[model samples]
Target: MADNLPPPSPSTSTHHDSTTKVTDMDIDSLVHCASYLTLHDISNMVLSCKFLNRVVYSDTIWRRLYREQWPEQEPYIISQTSCASAREAYLGRYTDLQRFKFVDPLVYDVHMGIGAKCSDLMFSNNSILFSQGPVIKILSIDKLLEGKTSIVSLNDHRARITCMRLFPLKETSLFRNKAQRNESVLVTSSSDHSIRLWWKGSCQRCFRGHNGPVTILSDKLLGDGTGKVFASGGEDSTVRLWSMSSGGKRGGQHALKATLYGHEKPLVLMSVVKHKASLLASVSKDSKVRVWDTTISSDRSSCCVGMTCVPGVPVGIKCHDSLLYIAAGSSFVAVDLRTMKTAFKTSTRNQPKLFSFDILPSKFLACTGGVGRAMLWDIRRSTGTGDADPMAELDGHVGPVTHLHMDSYKVVSGGREDPYVSIWDADTGNQTNILRSSSNLNLDGGGCGCCGMAADGFRIVTAAYNGEECVVNFRDFNNAVFYGAFSDNVTGSKFWCPSTSGHDHAGDESDV
Candidate 1:
């Protein structure tokens, strides 16, 4: 009865204390408090618990977590947060994972020299062309498969060849009514300050005007039915146009059409789009990219002069459809020709010195930098609103990556590293093959400093700075072999030329 007496009536006088204390707990502690939850679960926890809600809703904590766990999604996450209502405005825009195809390098070769620096490579038809010093090496892609030893060397340039382009013409009877039925022409530029045209079995004419070394050269098919115009740019800060026709009295001679000059520095890269037949874009060391109109007036048979300068020091430029893509510094920028304005810019987080870039047919752009890393960007989905990230980062190269070349399914990177040439699957970023330079079959002391790679069908060609060149057939992986090696002191660029007539055309094709 005493224990139940109104619960002992409570004390009338009580001591009261009025003080609020805040704890110095770190972000990690706050995150750990919600350890039993996933990210979505944390969001739910935030709604139900005030303390957990404040910690989860902290922008600094979330941003740090986003970058640490998913760097590629940082751009999209940041952009989404800038909206007034991120939950409703950007619900489907930010996914934090990417899948890539990995390829291994199957073949490897090396070339060593004092000042070897391979500049370019091309794969055309069945032949491969690479430049070193003042010569172009040509070889047969098929012979490499048969394990035959035959290499054709052409001493065509007085200086080091810097660039090359294969002008693809149709083999149809309607197109080549008079000239060689299925032969193709290779256009090359060199430090000897000249541009030359060459056919497989013939030494063609040279275009001379630049006082300095020719830096970049490219061509586009203009008009129809045997009428075509080729364009070239050089260190002389000029772009020249030439018309190719069957009416030449001499073989491979075309009429010079026009010369456009506005660049203050040597042109490093150039690209032409088919949609804008009269429009051409060039990037120079002067830190500017210029666009020119090549359309001819009704009365004046010469190209019309219209130019615009875009600000940037572009190291590489590529165009697909009506969109122009340029790689500058650590960013890749895309411009729409229709709007003549930048549409997209994505950061690679790489250092500025880059040697080469290649765009795949799947709209993925691969860029290599001086820092020995290669990044793949999905430019098609990247918008200025920042909703994209690099799909993959290739980190195998030990030194600076000089060049990147890609086909529909595979990618090859060249630089100063193990296995001078490395091949990967474009879809998964997985290594499919390792082309080592240490094989006994290699003649160029294993391999040289690979500068560029080009592919035609299943055959691949690699050019090195030490004047070493190799052609490999990937059809037989276990027995995949090197075709030939050119161990000359050639440098600059190399490429492959495929002959429509099913002729062997692989070699160390070089300029200068």
Candidate 2:
């Protein structure tokens, strides 16, 4: 009996031992397995073999995974109608999030622990400029990426640095003396009531006239091909235009070209619109938006071309076509530059204090503020009665959203609490990745001061109120290094690249 039980047919044993190989699995089985893997893992699988790549990289699978990761975007992704369109949208969003399994440690940071509050920051010519107290610290972006300290600290102001604008001049026979053909000019304003001009890091000229802190800087090119000039608005309730004068036929320093006074309160923001001619738009603490003609830059030479009162103090203003998009308090107001009237006004949920709002090319406005969320509204679909709801909401930050920056593909936001710079897909409003800080740390009594897009298009540089500097590379979105103590407290910052061609202020006509 034992022998009979032990004896089994060779055919039966062979059949029982048969197993299905992985390569033999159907597309459904492969996709099911791929679903459990992270995007990076799936990418690795695709790269492992040609057949796997063809099988694993299907748009259907990607669409399913994208929807799973960002369900709120399902409506938009599904509305593409055509499979090709949906796939293209998915790839666009996916490529912006680029799959990465690991990230290198924070690449670079310099500790400029000068404990002054940083008011603003900017990036240009492979360098980053940030204002701390009355001094501006410049760090080379390329040097920072290599973990080296290449800084040029300029202490030209007596008080705090409030605003800065960089203008690229066209070097021709007429304006050859203004600057080197390749070099751009830097204009900075300070609480010291002075605006200084810098060419190649040296303070070339200083214009002192404002009785209070200068908070705004805007520049426009002269139509006569002479040179470009800039405008500044300050706490003294005046807008002053300055240009490199050709005094006595000799190249002169920056001189006061025009002074227009209209705002009853300190101006918070200003923009020079190139529409029809150079038109200047300024917002003051008095809740009034004033437009001026830059051509007639003297007192009484210009009347407010388009003026409107909003429900809250205007903090930010952007112009596109004939519309002026304004951010005031927690409400967003749209003004028709032609009619000089408020076309639409709407408040974010809970009336969160809106810090900054940018108008995107898609006719959508992206705004962030005291809330832990970023709000988006379609201006074309609004009801124009201060009752429009957000078309989509991006929620991730644990702290009040401080600043936002948007480009062709993504929207990046930073807050005071979260150690991550949240990045969202511009089209779908889906959070694709979080640029995590190396240290799980929060700023004490400080938050993100500002954020700006780099010339590389794939990088975003941000400054924190506690003097922290951050750089996020979209190609590797998961990791970022926080260079804390770069300055005491950064109030404002900008990113400028030498490789940046054309005038920096030219397309700024549409910047938010």
Candidate 3:
């Protein structure tokens, strides 16, 4: 009976459970397992066997890795090569980021065709709207790629172009429901004492009444999201209301809706809230600030509900919930709009004194003074320690830091003290590269300082001197996509829509 229990086995007598081959698993299961491995680990895994090679390259595995590595890139990563797979997209950015260690090799180009020093610059779609003296040059990215070098010029302003801003255009398109983002109208102020509205690169209307140069343009639109109305201020010491629609207008006074007269000194900076019945704050050269109820700016008049004065002339003013943050010489102070009193003042411990300050998307404070270094402070941490360690110190400028722009990917600082634009990784707070002009005068020579700088994820636009010519240098990082000739996505992007969703998308903005 015992002999009938299967014939004698020729194999080894001791046998355990049969080993399960990884290749035997389903494709999905294999792909998921490989995802846990690092990119380098998967690279080696694929070479070990043909089956793993296929699994490592699967969309499921690569997509997860791509986003994890560069969450700021699209959820579906778009490869810089245009034809590569998700794996290629991940590899490209990974390699590009590695260039931070050796900055001299970072590839870039300078386009002197953008004209002399850009006093004001901005990106509209793909084309850049930059001011060179009084002329506005619109240059396309494709032209630069093809080496055309030619640009469209708009010389409507008689005097120098002082400031420029973009506000969301009211959606009137038949396919409005399908649009992912709102179209915008360009609102530019000039020393010519005029405020012009432009759409699709064409000037639609002009409103003129300022007695002196139009020195101030509200950074945000007034009212809700209509985009038809805006406000302007000038050295004449008056805040004038302007609208796109003929909202119950009388004769030819539609564009010049109303005038708000309260300030005594010349206008320095102004800010407007976008919410309904939103409040507008205007800062004058005399350091006095006036808060007006913009929603009440109807019936031919708007009332100044609150007023306050700062230590010295302010460089910037921004409106938040019930408060106005002013950047002055000694300190960055937040003044309560309701009570007209100083609510809180940022620490003045750092030397050189606070020349100006900005509120980052993180709600942390970034300040710049006469010194070369830009400091980041976490005001929240100060609650427990009375004084918190500086969150990050960006110190790479050759001299005094002039301007800086920060997004999720990196922090860019530049100034008149030096010619180079220092790019630092925001996450690591490490210097990545130094961007300069291709010209010998800009590269080896002195006097070429960055007067102004604007950056997106893929490119950096700088206002520098190429010898004696003030040139707007377009330094492209060779991104696979560009929206227009000077289209700037992300970086200094303004989110018009107010939200309290509480979802964190920190580096989620790829800004193509």
- Model 1's TM-score against the true structure: 0.63
User: Which regions of candidate 3 fall more than 4 Å away from where they truly are?
Assistant: 1-116, 171-181, 225-227, 246-253, 274-277, 297-302, 350-356, 361-363, 382-389, 437-439, 443-447, 478-512
Sliding window of 10 residues with minimal summed lDDT for model 3: 490-499
lDDT of 1 at 253: 38
Model 2 weakest lDDT span, ten residues long: 489-498
- Could you arrange the candidates by TM-score from highest to lowest? 3, 2, 1
Error of 2 at 365 (Å): 3.8
lDDT of 1: 0.55
lDDT string, candidate 2, 371-422, tens digits: 7787866667765665557777878676666667766566777665555566
Candidate 3 matches the true fold with a TM-score of 0.69
Candidate with maximal TM-score: 3
Give Cα distance to truth, residue 215, candidate 3, Å: 0.6
Error at 137, model 1, angstroms: 1.1
Candidate 3 local lDDT, 389-473, one digit each (tens): 4577777566666676766656777777577777665655666556663323444455567766776556667777645656666
Question: After aligning candidate 1 to the native by TM-score, how far in Å is the CA of 344 from where it should be?
Answer: 0.8
Off by over 4 Å in 1: 1-119, 169-182, 223-226, 246-254, 297-312, 350-353, 364-370, 385-388, 437-448, 464-512
lDDT on C-alpha atoms for all candidate structures: 0.55, 0.60, 0.63
Cα error of candidate 3 at position 238, Å = 0.9
Tens-place lDDT per residue, model 1, 1-512, is: 78765643336335436454323566567666554445677667667756666667655445454445435434445434433333322221121001111121143333323444444556556666666567777766567556664457678688888877777545211245546555667778888877777765545556766678888876565444545567777778887766655344343333566677677788887778757666777777875766667665342323423334444456677877777877766667777777767877776543555555677635465654546667766665677733346777776675677667776666677674434556666776665444432332233443345545565544455554333444322221221111212211111111111112211322221110
lDDT of 1 at 354: 56
